[model samples]
Target: MKSATQDKRVFTEQETSHYIGMSRSFLRQSRMEGLRKNRTQAPPFIKIGRAVRYLKEDLDQWLDSHRKMHQLPHEGGAHV
Candidate 1:
């Protein structure tokens, strides 16, 4: 079996923000707060020196976990 990191698609902070449809600052704040609170509810990321990156597979899983499948359209569920 291959490790999760192996063959993963890495994205820069800017790219991740765009891919996730969130602001870069929001991503940074989420990471900072998650680290400060030692919480695991946020999406996973990697920090190398002064740079940060997110894995495409990880982001997909995170988004899936947060997805709302039963909510009405007006209940703030994503419109598809």
Candidate 2:
């Protein structure tokens, strides 16, 4: 059994931003852009009426999808 906090499946925008290390405004802007573009620009979210919520699993997946490997110095840039 898990505690309520530990079992939380939905999070508010602010909580998602903090959990993902992004600013609230950034998330907001992304959502706005997504609306105008008719595409999702940020992590998947749920719209519960006027509130936006993010799932922990979705956030984790989004972060994983965005993972990048750092380029070795010799692998990029100067050929000299």
Candidate 3:
């Protein structure tokens, strides 16, 4: 059995990068882009001094918001 405290999903920058299969720099880039695009309304995050942490739920929601669906191939052919 998992304790409620242990079950809480809080991750550091490195953990988040690993979880998302992206480099730490890429995560920073994404964070910058999010800031540039005023994505505060998109997801919630915590900024502690020089370190930035993210909740799994917020990251999941952010990914869902940025997800691209129904993108057709450049060949311009429909998949039947």
Best model number under TM-score: 2
| Candidate with the larger TM-score of 1 and 3 | 1
- TM per model? 0.68, 0.71, 0.59
> In candidate 1, which residue ranges exceed 4 Å CA deviation?
1-8, 35-41, 73-80
- Tens-digit lDDT track for model 2 on 1-80? 86453467898887888788898988988877774556446988889899999999999899898787876467456865
Sorted by TM-score (best first), the order is 2, 1, 3
Give candidate 3's error at residue 71 in angstroms: 3.3
Worst 10 residues of 2 by lDDT: 32-41
Q: Give the better candidate number (1 or 3) by lDDT.
A: 1
Alpha carbon lDDT of residue 45, candidate 2?
87
Compared with the true structure, the alpha-carbon lDDT of candidate 1 equals 0.77
lDDT of 3 at 63: 73
lDDT of 3 by residue, 5-80 (tens): 3355988887776666668777777667765554333245589898788898887877788777987466866668
Model 3 residue runs over 4 Å out of place are: 1-8, 32-34, 37-44, 74-80
- Positional deviation of residue 13's Cα in model 2 after best superposition, in angstroms: 0.7
Clashes of 3: 0
lDDT of 1 by residue, 1-80 (tens): 96444455998887787777788888878777774545445579988898888989999998888787785557656669
